[model samples]
Target: MKTLFLLLLVILFISGNKPGLSQDNNLQKNLGADNKVKIQSIIFNDIETGIVNNDVKKFSQYLSAQTYLSLINGVNGYYSSNQAYYILEDFFNTFKVVSFKIKETKTAESVSYGKGDYYFEKKGKREVAHLYVTLNKAGSKWYIAQISIN
Candidate 1:
């Protein structure tokens, strides 16, 4: 009986030492992920508003240090945030936004993509184009890493 008691005690000690996944830890991690998704959604909403209103000022704050843009006007490549701002400003000035709407969005752990419709008029010629933007999370903030209007 003494030996059996020692064996049981040892078994309990070993099992208790195991770091099996805890429900609280899992819940915390899930909440963190939910917060990130919420942030992505909010940022995308701001970006959509900016595009719809033809006002980069609405979302320019989210531009990454170096942003990649492929504009219909033939400006393509990575550019500084300041340069990207002016480039987008120029595009908006020339195209003239009739409407902009985000049709779909996908979010991952560290990146998110938004695809939408851009209806614009150039010198009274109205057309619609596909708009795609990528957002990358750095630290606790999301930044616009890429924008393509095709």
Candidate 2:
């Protein structure tokens, strides 16, 4: 009778312990997912504000080393992070951003897509352009991997 009682206690303890493990695993998964979403949000916010303020340094922070820029009229180029930084610097020097707004955003796992409208003043004329961007999580932070202008 004592042996049976001890076995019952052991079984109860083991069974009781499993829910804690499951809960911990679930919590970890949720936390990781939430972190991905937060990273995406941060990347978008930085890019939008950077472009609006013509802050090339702020924009460079969210660009990966192997980022690619594609224009709507079939001009595609691959740029290192440093190249991208200089490109943005030149762009900011050329045009003044009048206003910028994000039209929509979609996120999935480690990827995010954003569409936006940008108003720029170039040579004293205001021009509007549609911007499409894709960002991916790289390590612990999100980086802009691709951008297209239309």
Candidate 3:
């Protein structure tokens, strides 16, 4: 009877420990994911507004120092913060934005990404382009790391 009771106790302890280890792994995976939802919303909303209104200053406010931009027919490459600002300014000048809408937004770990559609006019011709932007979180703030329009 003594040996049987010891075995039962050991089994129960092992079972409890297994679940705790698994739970800990899950908790670690989900850590740092909370509190990002609101930030992502605000940043994406600001981006949408800036594009729709062709406000380079407002858009530049969120750009990372190493921001990269790839446009369909214009500039394409990694650019410094100031260079990107001017490139965007030129793009906006060449194509007048009629509408900008975000279709999807996703966040993983320290990175947030979005996809949308850009409707604009260039030389009296309407054009539609797909837009993608990726943002990286630094401390308590998010910065636009890359942008693509095609």
Candidate 4:
């Protein structure tokens, strides 16, 4: 009887440990999912407002330190956060944004991609372009890592 009781106690202890381990893994997965949702919301808000106002300062808030931009003609360039802000400033001066709208957004892990339609008034002529933007999460903030216009 004594030996049987000891074996039963050991089995109970081992069984209890497995559930605790599984719970911890579940918690981690939930936290990761929550972070991805938050990052997506921040990126959408930043881009939507930035384009409408032509505000580089607001736009740069979503950019990482090592952001790269590609233009419509297959031109590629990399910029630091500050440099990217300056480029946006130049864009604001050159073209007036009449309207902007986000067409779609997709998220994966720590990256998000967005496509949007933009209407611009350049030299009193209306032009439309589709913009593609990619964002990556850095710590607790999401930043724009790449942008392409075509």
Q: What are the Cα lDDT values of the candidates?
A: 0.85, 0.74, 0.82, 0.74
Candidate 4's C-alpha lDDT? 0.74
Best of the two (1, 3) by lDDT = 1
Give the per-residue lDDT of model 4 (tens digit) for 1-150.
Answer: 999999999999888776653323433444563455354655576678878988866566667788887754454799888887787677756767899888898988888899988788778998887889998877755678998766
Best by TM-score: 1
Q: Count the backbone clashes (under 3 Å) in each candidate.
A: 0, 0, 0, 0
Question: Clashing pairs in model 4?
Answer: none
Judging by lDDT, tell me the better candidate of 3 and 4: 3
Flag clash pairs in model 2: none
- TM for every model, in the order presented, reads 0.75, 0.69, 0.73, 0.69
Q: Write the per-residue lDDT of candidate 2 for residues 23-104, one digit (tens) a residue.
A: 2343345456345535566567767888888886766767788888875335478899898788767766676779987779
Better of 2 and 3 by lDDT: 3
Q: What digit string (tens of lDDT, one per residue) describes model 1 on residues 27-144?
A: 3444563455376676788788888888898778888999999989999999988999999989999999999888899999999999999999999999998999999988866789
Error of 2 at 136 (Å): 1.1
